[model samples]
Target: MRFARAIALGAVTAVTGGLLAAVPAAAQATGAPAASAAATVSVTLTGKAVRADGRAVDEVGVFVVPAARWVDEDAAPVSTALVADNGRYSVTASVAAGSSLYVRVDDWTSSDGYMDRLFVGKGGKAAFTYVGLAPIAAKAGTIELGTATAPKLSTVRVTTSAPVHCAKLLRKNGTLAAMECDYTVDKKVFTFTGMYPGEYTVGAMWSSWTDARATVDVSAKKGVTTAAMLTLESPTTMTGVVQDTQGKALEGIAVWANGPDSPRTVTDATGRYAFKGLTAGSYVVDYSGASGMSSAYRDYVTRTSTVSVTSGRVTTAGSTLTKGAQVTGSVTPLAKETYGTIVALAADGHVLASDSYWSSDGKKRDFALHGLPTGTHTVVVQDAASGRYAKSTVVVSGTSARTVGALKPAAAPVTVRGTVEGTTAGFVSLRYGTSPLYRGAIDGGDVKPDGSYAITHVVPGIYALRSHRTTSTAGYEGNLLSVTVGDGVAVRRIPQPTRKVQTLQTLVRTSVTFDGRALPGVVPLPRRTPADLWGNWTNEKGVGQAPWTGRAWDAVVLEDVFFAYHSPYYFVVKSPTSVTKPGDLANVTVARVAGGPTV
Candidate 1:
């Protein structure tokens, strides 16, 4: 699986010195490779960004990164700047003036609000040119980069059968998008407006039934409206009673579905348990607390039962239990690099889909355990030699998608730093020790955008430097850096190696190893540490890396103002008390970030 990468060496005629007739690597989702062109020219793109309603955008991140980054996402920019106060942008980037390149914003902060990864110039179809552009002169100036119209929210209306109450909108990434949604009982429609462009699914309850597939896959394009109708055929329900050897009904026993997607509930006083809103599928149900049904049933340990459910149908697989108490649960991992990653469940299991089912967000990383009749049922999560953490613990609980959180690296608090490329912003980290790995970093404030960084409060030990940029691009490679702190010692700059983005994963998974003799997990930053996150954040799982904030480094979760999905994101308004609806917004204005917008 070699990824097609464009090496933009010292400004040349074409992106990679010259364009190759055939690319040996596979093109990524961002866009295609740049074609060849003469280096005899330079380009200066001038433009302004505005909303669909003709309002100017200012101070947004306006730059010329690699034209290939649009396709090969990990690629960083070569030249950068901000849109001016008057909504005008001028940048003379070093590109083969005639070659194809991309000019856009990586993250956007506009009048309505902020979008983490927004792209302008994606209008016309030249494929992935961000809406391809025309070539310019050898140093062309103010060539009208064109206006990027801010994307408006999409209204997705989900129609279900009858008065199916309670519908939720979740990001395709498996995170909740809208909570406690409002629905129209008469029309059986759950409508959510003010949505950004992305994929979403409906995770909600139907009338008297709960369904995993209550809605089809719905995509929202900016300024577009979409509707998905989920026809509830024959709704299905599975009901059965749990009993002891004496046939006495077992009460208060918890029956849980092995897959995190399924629902769980307690048996009734009559020892009866039921599951509703089920589609035809194989399910594993395990019980907790049944060792005491009666003297005759006291020695029985319940085995996991296999039940198959079909669309609009029910299947029951209940069992009688002797005396036994056990614990089990599901683990959900949250990143792309999270695939092939094995997770260690303390009792006796790892994240294997065939047994532990993968989730729908992307490639699912789900796992559960049965058989644990005795022992502390600690929900600890360990990585499969491929994840960032050597081991993580499931700290929070709740089986529902939004409520459940797990598989995060344990925190390590030592400090360390180095200059990988002495270039770009310092959005870097340092991970050390071995399994139960420790991830720590130098303060973002200590690391300059030029890449010069420093780490204080170091725990004397050996560590590894992991980065994605090359020396050519000003990044470091994975290698060992030893720190020895005497009673009173000054910190020194650790030497860096070459950075290879292509091999970053390999370094992350293979090349790097911890000193091992210490505690197993990620180290934390110095206390009172304030880091940076580029834009808005949804409820992300696990403390992890974030986009560079052009400022001091940050921790996993930071403090910020959050609003509800239905709440308006204001830029400027007539008066706080004067505006309440869309009509009231007609005359208000907002103060942009960094004096960003042109008044």
Candidate 2:
């Protein structure tokens, strides 16, 4: 008990800078008596946040962190809640009974900024000292911590001597904390509001060149504004002209400077193109134009040249265009599948040209690529729904148009099945490893309460199985398991054996509704907020049920966006209206919060 007391005190003091004044020293030290793991409890921390001047915060972000991870730089909130305009918040998170935890409160409202922008500290990292209390035991019911004081938010404004096309604010640790590009065109200034008082670096740029940088400290007082000025250095410029091999100026040719800012312009009447306000650097200038030979077809000329630009001086890079080749092809998609992008890739893996196809379009499934340099290219076509793709190699010689005939059909996609042992609180995904065919990880569905998972529409190949914790914002930790799928395997269960995941026998039948209308495609995120997703966002009707876990509250359901930005409507299940025991119906209704973000 004394060891527990010491660890609790050290952890809390390290986070809060002091002890909670409301709780007695003996109570803080003793905490709640240790309970067996089977006796894990759902604890609710209720509290209010006040500003330095003792005024109640309009809305505050309340978070609970386990003491074990309080010092971990990437620690995530075990549970999160938002205080109402009334300054009161109640958030629930499941923890082992007798576990010591920390409660944090900050001046982060959804209206002003994002959760990551809460408060900036030492290295431009989110500071956690605004309002914190810790070492509280995980009791079965609500625990009230008295009002905690937090600092007032601050604002900073930056002005530049010259017009800055872009600017960024850096944290003390040189991290690109923010680029609150709220630029005032007339004043050549940038405004950053609702920032935690601290030292920050401001860097301004014209085009892609760094003009100047300045450091300033934001005042800690409420409504006090910090201001800083940045002076510019001499500017750089890059100019170019384009003409055909016949010495004829190619007016209206597209000219591009591929460098820092990638400025682009079209050749004027004199075939001249200029890019001012550039950074001092080397640039590759590209010129492209088409010569009218006949109404049936036009020969396209494309050329490139490299030039170096110096500060306060104009550098010229000109190019004489030569006819380039074109690549044309047709694609045939699999039955019931739509065509995705058809890309012509060079041997170096750079995409030369790309176009899309649709099954619904009346035109033939034909694609064409113009202005391609004479080279060998791999023409690839992928199915939109399925990641299956086909590729064909073609060669273009001396401005001659090369044709790739109808591409062969891609191999059929396969399904993968696996079991995630130990915990039912996370999802399993199949990530492509060194597979040029697939682009990203295929959603393997959420690990069911029984720990079994099946992922469909996966391209047959070697893949890495990634386990993502449902309660943490930190995405896919590492490849926990590897899976190799072969063609013609309809449904192959991974060699990994299925293991039982412990669960609280309590089954809660729940139905979610928004504004009295039953909402479909809502995910049941047990004990966590909408910010932490379980990733099993398949279509489940409003009336769904799940077994409660030992390490979770009743449930928190959010509208499933299914790989897209989510809707703002969500609800927390405190208790059922009628039956409260195992295998009972838990009917819940969620109303949209007034003035909250809408879908």
lDDT of 1 by residue, 1-599 (tens): 01121211111111122111111123212232343544445566666655556545543332343332222222454556766655566656665443444454433443243332233332211111221122222233445656655545567777776445566675432334564433323236777666654556665664333533455566665556778666654556566888776898887666766442366666767888776666556677765443223333322344467777776776766777654332233444444444322222323231111122333463435454322333332333333322223233333222211112444433233345456544544343443332112223322223466666655533333334344334321334444444433333334454334444221110011010011111111111211222221222211111222222122322221211221232211111112223122232122121111101110
Best by TM-score: 2
Task: Note the residue pairs that clash in candidate 2.
Answer: none
- Candidates in order, TM-scores: namely 0.35, 0.39
Off by over 4 Å in 1: 1-37, 40-42, 53-70, 110-139, 162-227, 240-252, 256-287, 290-311, 314-599
The alpha-carbon lDDT assigned to residue 543 of candidate 1 equals: 20
| Candidate 1 TM-score versus the reference | 0.35
Residue 52 of candidate 1: its Cα lDDT?
54
Query: Candidate 2 lDDT, tens digit per residue, 128-209?
Result: 3311233555668987765655544556677877666666665432333446443222236787665544445677655443
lDDT of each: 0.39, 0.51
Q: How far is candidate 2 from the true structure (C-alpha RMSD, Å)?
A: 18.6
